[model samples]
Target: MINKVQILSVTLPGNLDAYIRIANLWPMLSIEEEKSLTQRLRYNSDLDAAKKLILSHLRFVIHISRNYSGYGLPQADLIQEGNIGLMKAVRRFNPEIGVRLVSFAVHWIKSEIHEYVLRNWRIVKVATTKSQRKLFFNLRKTKKRLGWFNEEEIKIVAKELGVSSKDVREMESRMAAQDVTFNPLPEEDFVDGKNNNTIQYLQDKTSNFACRVEKDNWEEHATNKLSNALLGLDKRSRDIIYARWLDKNQKNTLQTIANNYGISAERVRQLEKNAMKKLRIAIEA
Candidate 1:
């Protein structure tokens, strides 16, 4: 039986180089030996048998993780997630099913790596629905060149994938989109050496103190005129306007205002519209 600490020491390497060296140490098991060990682990909960199975498969996990290197995520992290899936496959593997352990474990390993890639590939998710997720991973392989797909190629891909040409176009657009930071870093600057942050461009340069004061005076004058206009209206129209628009906390609906006044909804709407027209004339005057 292998020592638990010894197995842990070799299986968990400090770096990729050490990981490759450690994986090479474990020899592949024959069908007979694998069945015997699998039976032992399955029926008796043998820790040594489980450890041997995991150690022998570390090389396979490393191989699978390499395929996902183009995603720009750390290779070591991908291998780690694949390792978790390999362990899960080992736990549920039925040796009686007449398939090799490697064949059974491949699905589990790829699933884990796919999940990791989708989660860490970008800040915003590239795929949300089932078809989008399928298109996201498979679309890259369909493209033969570095440039965008032509119309004939788009039709071919759409028919092959069982999706519309429009969907293919949309996914292609999303794939081309790159993430940009909302704010520029300290080192980032314009050609003239001024800070080029988004905040600098977002400020309203036309809103000076004089412009703000003039706008405020106009607003005050409009409020006074509107108040005088409301006073000129009958009590019912004044109450309906106040309830429908002036009250910030709880604006009443036309139906609710109609119920309050014992009138129909159409009457309430008419009254509100007339009130607005009078206010507009008063303010304009």
Candidate 2:
């Protein structure tokens, strides 16, 4: 007979079709089961309980990930980020809070996916502020399907989203702007050109092999030094630094980290500042 506690692992596949099939294969837990498992994980920190919770919710992650498919990112990557959010949700779940796991997990899950999409949707970042991010994922879709918004329509969108018409117009301009590609490849995509001619036209003596090699070596050494400096700091300092700067378009808020670590946001800020100073000194040396 199988034990009362279930221990199923989620092995996501590169073939999204198979992944969906396997994800949906994990039977969703009933309300009672969800409540009980959350209790076990919360009260006892039971690893099996956590595993069971994560497996049961894999299908939810897949479903939510589908909503982001239009971003033209790999489906597997979106699902993986959703899985991370689900795991975090599971870690902090509270059955006593009187809400289902899925309800609580949705915010965390979307937060992760949103960061991933914003960071990757363009070579140059398209969304930096809150309103811009809102328009990028929400209003931009409307523009894609319906074409440009009229003045009246822009006002309507602004009212609905609680922003100024000027904000919407600015986003419209940004969306319409064409991206410029820097560092165009030399001759690889050319229809007809001599290799030496292409190289001569595209690169100067300053772009010689020696300079390129030195640049790459210096970058690698600097990265290693930064890594070592981060390792020297305590875990909290490392986490704060990554969340604030290293992780571009970070979704982790200062208040959220402070709450998680049971400290003040001011304290978190000070820690981040000190950590950055240490890193700068280490890197400069």
Candidate 3:
């Protein structure tokens, strides 16, 4: 009996509050009205019928979006994503299935909102697997207190959710961990652009990448020279150098080398010094 889009000529307000007010002001459709609109859109591709169904459901999307406010994403974004879900539900609704549009649309609405929450809730995703995702959304409600879960509580939650206690603890730890600010804020104490033991080192500058590349290149270059220098030495000298510095165990003392060579420790030390000088000269050359 009423033209739903009467305010089409009126430019919609750009603010969230005004958009929510408009959504709330939209009148709810009757059962018969909804069925007729759904049938028209489903059978004949009636654009006006689809538009009415979507407009009537915006308030429902806003209601569902409010449930995710704890996630700290923008309210407008949540509602916008939920509205997409509502549209999808409307597109797939079959009148012969004998279910209310609201009943069918709730799943679609929450699905979009859940995806939005997971994607933007944190800098790093806390839930990746099926079990972790279940923990992410339901763990908040299962939590009985304001602090970390005790051993008994963890076991209870794990049993209740059908997940391991380790998983529960891991998810809880992930939830408790706050994102670190990579760069120093303007108010941070930087002495000559340096902050000691701070997250300032986490800043991903282009220069830092270049420095790492250069360091790797120099180390590789030095390793090549050292390998060539070792080859130039006599068998005994090479064995002495390898036993002294290149041995991973670090158990080859001067006396151990001398014992194997049947020479005095002093002789071993002098040979080491002479071999190191020759290697240095060969490397620098």
Query: What TM-score, to 2 decimals, does candidate 1 have?
Result: 0.64
Q: All candidates' TM-scores? A: 0.64, 0.61, 0.63
Model 2 scores a C-alpha lDDT of 0.82
- Tens-digit lDDT string for candidate 3 (122-178): 889999887888898889766635367899989988998999999999999998889
After superposition, the stretches of candidate 2 with alpha carbons farther than 4 Å from their true spots are 1-11, 188-285
Which residue ranges in model 3 land beyond 4 Å of their true spot? 1-13, 144-146, 185-285
Which pairs of residues collide in model 3?
none
lDDT per residue for candidate 1 within 1-285, as digits (tens), equals 224322332235667888787887899999998998888877777878888998898999999998888778988889888987888778888889998899999999998888888888888888888798888888876753535898988898889898999999999998888976658767775537766676666767766999889999999988888899888888988999999889989989999988887999999999989988987887777
lDDT of 3 at 74: 86
Query: Per-model C-alpha lDDT, please?
Result: 0.83, 0.82, 0.84
Q: List the candidate 1 regions with Cα displacement exceeding 4 Å.
A: 1-12, 144-146, 189-196, 199-285
Number of the candidate with higher TM-score, 1 or 2? 1
In the range 144-213, model 2's lDDT, one tens digit per residue, is 7768889899988889888899988888887677654443466553445534333345556565788889
Worst 10 residues of 1 by lDDT: 1-10
Error of 2 at 163 (Å): 1.0
